[model samples]
Target: AYDGGSPTRSSQMRLDIVILDINDHAPVFNQSRYQALISESLLPGASVLQVYATDADQGPNGDVRYEINRRQSDPEGYFTINAQSGLIQINKPLDYETRKVHELVVQAKDGAEQPEVGTAFVSIQVRDSNDNQPSMTIIFLSEDGAPRVSEGANPGQYVARISVSDP
Candidate 1:
């Protein structure tokens, strides 16, 4: 290390050089965007996906904490984050029929005082689950609009209409 731009000539005099870390660099995510698909039948508190980031700063200044921007990004309140781990987890059940896509912003901030921050976008696609039971409606009638059955009836003698729907 040079003191005042001039190196002090010393051998056994013992000159200690220390480099300090400053919060000059902001945390940066490895990727600008991350996407994943999850089933709508997934329960709450399940881990869906994760995002990673890095900071050039040293020591505590490089340590990052993750968070979700609820007001502007996660308005539906469907997700959570591990502050120190950068893991994004689910907070509630998902419904693909009502809504298919969820967009949220993830923020990474350093542990330094007046910490530098960074952000990334996350897109979660909810896949429809075959959990809904089909609803069926049946109507039976004769050609003359009267219900009549015969043991010796010919083929195509009965008229029945069945309709089914599911979500």
Candidate 2:
């Protein structure tokens, strides 16, 4: 060996790196818009439907929570949603005569410090129920002013003019 100039040995090694995930993805609903048809007789606290969403990120960033957007027009407070389960339920009585259709905006947000949010539109159509009793108006056609059938009344004869209606 001629001092430091003689030779210099070299060593080579391989290195690997791992990249962790961040809260970069927002929750996405299975459907952007949903529709349901329910009867007006549906009672309070009854389950209406379920909404679902998913996040692509890992850990807490991927966790999704559900909510009914209060910013939307829900003046009747007719519906509620489960924060963790995304189950939509009826919060009040439904009346087809009062309002036949309801529109709601639901939100899904990720569990992040600065959460990302996704929105879905829900349309509920209330089917008419037999909630109202039929009203009747009768006008007697008999010779007597009172509501009575005469003994000599002919068969299939019109006894009274009846009108019925329901709202």
Candidate 3:
């Protein structure tokens, strides 16, 4: 059985090798939907929340980078993401009266070439911020010439009317 006998009784030699996994896995978010509450008056660079994702692939395939998916629905550019850290930060001030809740689509991509992408929804509720100051105006009844308050002005008599408004 010198040949075509599967090397029996010859100096039988076999080698064992491990085939590593390829970079075929996509990044997966810890949660399908993430909720966060942030003050509307936060600074532009303020950190809102940190997003986390994991990949089953090994080596560079497991490394993830984050990004905000901007589209027609997301007209307001009020958020930014740190690619390396997956940290979401405020890009601008939020107005509760104008828009209360903001929905952002975040994508996580592996470091591999032609990396696979994963999407996650991050709902950010803009909390009320006491950043507005009330504006008021006081109007005193004036005569034809001007307002002249006498020293004996009656307390019950109407002196002035105040109006308040806020923007």
True-vs-predicted CA distance for residue 63, candidate 2, Å: 0.7
Instruction: Report the candidate with higher lDDT, 1 versus 3.
Output: 1
Cα lDDT listed for each candidate: 0.87, 0.91, 0.85
Over 52-128, each residue of candidate 3 has an lDDT whose tens digit, in order, gives 99999998889999988898225678999999999998888778878889999999999898899999999999888
Give one digit per residue, the lDDT tens place, for model 2 in 17-124. Answer: 877779999999999999999999989999889999999999899999999988785767999999999999999998999999999999999999999999999999
Residue runs of model 3 more than 4 Å from their true location after superposition: 1-8, 14-16, 72-76, 137-163
Model 3, residue pairs in steric clash: none
Per-residue C-alpha lDDT of model 1 across residues 29-145, encoded as one tens digit per residue:
999999999999889889988899999999999998899988778777899889888788889888898889999999999989899989999999999999888999877676675
As a whole number from 0 to 100, the lDDT of residue 38 in candidate 2 is 96
Worst 10 residues of 3 by lDDT: 1-10
Ranking by lDDT: 2, 1, 3
RMSD of each: 5.5, 4.9, 4.2
Query: Which candidate comes out best when scored by TM-score?
Result: 1
